[model samples]
Target: MSLSLEGKHALIAGGSGEMGYHAARALAAAGCNITLMARGSEGLTTAATRLINEVDGDVLTVTADLNNRLSIERAVDHAEESLGPIDILVHAVREDVNGYYDQLDVARLQMAAQTLLIGAANLVAAVVPPMQEAGDGRVMFVIGQDAIRGRPLGLGTCALQHGLLGLMRGLAREVAESGVAVNAVVAGLVDTDRLSVEIDQIVAHTRRDRSAVKSDLANGNAQRRLIQPSEIGATLVWLAQDEAKGLCGQAMVIDGGELG
Candidate 1:
């Protein structure tokens, strides 16, 4: 499959974070014009600049709070205006409230649902019109391992994650005739700068050795190591390619082999 994405325009929500940042770099390197959207301008600017320095693309930033519908609407409009119609859309946003299911509050649950599920639906709605008209579009969602198998880690996130599968499937069916594809990339133990800090916190809180913490993080995966953000980024790039037309409504697991 030809992976060349030359001239494609990509709108990435939560593009300033680890997953989004590398996806932007991968897409840009693959020849897609890039736009990064995040809640903060500082990270957006830094991410855009880094992408520009690393790859050739017209990189831009859009600041919007994902939980706010109006803010999202404006950001989508601005992103489309900045880079033209979005040929590729990557929703890499994540909202996690960790705790036992019973310990979570109703309001926090709602917020997580809005950010991961409703927010994604709204973004896709905004970008799909142009795609449907153009008869071509690729949408990829960055999801967590929690979406794949049930674990105690993110009891609060199961609803959002599972709902995402349903949302993507429905959207995929809706846009199939229009030559658009929607899918999720389920990632596990992604090794990022954020993960490094997280490892530190785990060791301090649990009074476990660094090695043990790292081991537990990779325990469910066969590879027993963290996945790189770029690996997921590259996977997103591949999913957006013309060769991936048949992949709609699918969840591409990038975890290093989940344990049975």
Candidate 2:
């Protein structure tokens, strides 16, 4: 019943983004040392400072590209060297693609694959082995709801999202006996900076009021509101705990009942 993560270390792959920031916040608050790995040093530093001010643990930032395998390996090594073994690995990446099926080309597809699938594989390869040797670890992916159901004009995005789910499930079974629980947090429309830009675009196209557009989008879900980043953060923290050991190979959907 305990959820204390004291003395643990967590590496958040997309730690500069909204979801990643919140996840790192929650994990750090739960007493986990945090290593935020992302491509941008400025954003990573900003995020690390925010975490340092808000939580109790060493906050380290590593600048690395998710599209490159060697970059991911080196970043993980740096984090482990700084904070010791990573007890939890969170892949909260955001790869934006023009998902129109007709507009999709090999380049776009490769970009998506490299970011979502191949980069994830590289990260797992880098961290999971040491976790297995230590006999305990938590691996989580923060992904979108498109992985479960398709949306119009988002074929490429949905395919990559589902591919991540497939990877999580397959790897969960493979590492079941290794004492490493692998799962994913399937998120819905969250009220983040990214969503604000999207809402602004809708406003510009429709010439509608910003609040009205937000309301209409919120009504897509039964909750009639957008999900908060902190909620997803809480979920990631919970899944990283020992209590969630049995919740492996599953997509913990946090869509405010939107999927229904």
Candidate 3:
């Protein structure tokens, strides 16, 4: 199916980060007016400027901490005021709390859940009313492979990510007839700047060589290589298009064959 987002407005949370930045760029290129939301204004400004230089469309940056409901609401209001009602919502915000169950503190676990699951729910709630009234919208959560296949080291993150899947499924069923489609993309090890830093930390903690760590991760996937952030971004752009209306309550995994 042809994927086109002409005249669409998209709001991407965590849009200052690696995967989020690429996703925003792809959506903007696909003809969607983009509003990128993040916690810090510095990264948001840089990302927005880069996207504007690359895509011939409207781009706005909003800074909001998802941990606070008031902040999220204010950011959504600012985005709506600047770029009309958001026709597509991409919840890419995630707290990077990588640790074994024993190492994870209660506070960190709660933060992960709040950022990954609760924050996404809040964003959806803010946008869905208008979308339902208009009779059209798309919401997607950018998840991780651990959401499906739990890893011991990813306990907190996995729990939150899987919870997001359930959230999407329930919301999708609730809004299907209203022309709102909710889904998720479960991504694997991607070669993004964020991933690189995460991998470095993992290697240091595990006491493994960088090359060996990379190889071990690659071996889990059929492609035997790290996925590109741009690839994930492209898939999200396709999912946001009108032609993907039939795809709802689905978790599309782009991990090569890792989860298979």
The 0-to-1 C-alpha lDDT of every candidate, in the order given, reads 0.84, 0.88, 0.85
lDDT of candidate 2 over 119-157, digit per residue (tens) = 888889888999999889999999988889887556777
Error of 3 at 153 (Å): 1.7
Please give the clash total of every predicted structure, in order.
0, 0, 0
TM-scores, all models, native as reference: 0.92, 0.93, 0.94
> How many pairs of residues in model 3 come into backbone collision?
0
Question: Which portions of model 2 miss their true places by more than 4 Å?
Answer: 201-210
TM-score of 2: 0.93
lDDT of 3: 0.85
Point out the higher-scoring one by TM-score: 1 or 2.
2
Highest-lDDT candidate: 2
List the pairs of residues colliding in candidate 3: none
Cα lDDT of model 1 by residue, 18-127, tens digit: 88998889999889999899989998988888888899979989988766778888988888888888899898887766666677777988888978887887787777
Task: Identify the leading candidate in terms of TM-score.
Answer: 3
CA lDDT, candidate 2, residue 188: 93
In model 3, the runs with Cα more than 4 Å from the true position are none
lDDT of 3 by residue, 60-91 (tens): 99988776778888988999999899998988
